[model samples]
Target chain A: MSDKIDNISVGKKANVFFDGKCVSHSVFFPDGSRKTVGVIMPGAALTFNVGAPELMEITAGECQVRIAGEPDFKTYAAGSSFKVAENGSFEIHAKDEVNYICSFGSD
Target chain B: MSDKIDNISVGKKANVFFDGKCVSHSVFFPDGSRKTVGVIMPGAALTFNVGAPELMEITAGECQVRIAGEPDFKTYAAGSSFKVAENGSFEIHAKDEVNYICSFGSD
Candidate 1:
């Protein structure tokens, strides 16, 4: 296991592994696991697929999370927590920019 | 497993099971596992022992986390993440009433 903590700045990106799948631009823990926390600027969007169940908490601002093929997006505000199953495809859009943390099981 | 999501208010308390010890006032996910997110007020203190390694992210404010018998305390600021091993004793003090999220593995 890689125990490296990486701090990525705005406009920069990193890759995180979730059960062998790659989630790009994911802020990782020091252990190089799938768990991460970072800020997402307004008008920004990210898409990825998770291989294990995932949990996220909206710490600041607000964002819209849409699961693939799902109608109607979910609005996540500060202090909100939600879960996504493994192998679920997700896309996140920041309405006015927001910061959130995401964690998932290790491979 | 209990897949219930509970919303807790300030000055309120809840119990979370880590391994077998009771960690009080822990905000849990909707799925009802150890993973949680909540706010810790200033001057407020909490003590608990985790059974699995924990990952926490400070979404707002600042606080001090001190492990049992540790000489000095570690300060966590907004946008910072840290880990605590399972079975490790820890105490958290909000320097000026901060809000943060704490998550851990299930039993």
Candidate 2:
């Protein structure tokens, strides 16, 4: 995977959630696509509600993730990814400080 | 000030600091310059060491900042900015969740 996303527009401000347990910035692609680059604090277990289908690509660290309706929590590590359907939610527990890029709108 | 930075590249990974109290994403400019978009958690009082002189521009929220060699703390709010010399440090206490862009290099 590319280390950086080029020629895109990014919001100057950040999107803070979970009282700062999760922090992310919004990146806008020229093709009208949007993504978020984020970091989750270690040992923080949080549930994220998805508005669209999302592909969560781990760039660093590891996490245990359980998508809504899934029976088991799966471990996702660096270079790994998981998908959540639109209108769904997922619970994530960061095994370490997890860095991830979240792509929305599709599986 | 511009709400979004266009035509730049952003790192997929986040830079987490202070036990995840501070998180930022690197933005690379075509001019070979770099900046970071970041958020500081509310009630967090932290010090950041500077490698190069930096301009810290507030994007949202508010904070009180005391740059090294300065005797007093000054409050900075949205659209405001401060400069810190290289090899120096600054203490910042967020009044709320603070969103800022730190542009490195001389003022």
Best by DockQ: 2
lDDT of 2 by residue, B74-102 (tens): 99999999999989999999999899999
Name every residue pair that clashes in candidate 2.
none
lDDT of 1 by residue, B1-107 (tens): 11222232111122223211212233323354544444444456777676787777676678888876688889998778777777887887767535445678632
Q: Which stretches of candidate 2 lie over 4 Å from their true place?
A: none
For each candidate, report its DockQ versus the true two-chain complex.
Answer: 0.02, 0.87
Model 2 deviation from native, Cα RMSD in Å:
1.1
Clashing pairs in 1: A42-A97, B42-B97, B50-B87
lDDT per residue as tens, model 2, A1-107: 78998999999889999988899999999999999999999999999999889999999999999999999999999999999999999999999999998999864
Docking level for model 2: high
Residue A95 C-alpha lDDT in model 1:
75
C-alpha displacement of B96 in model 1, angstroms?
39
User: Which residue window of length 10 is worst by lDDT in model 2 chain A?
Assistant: A98-107
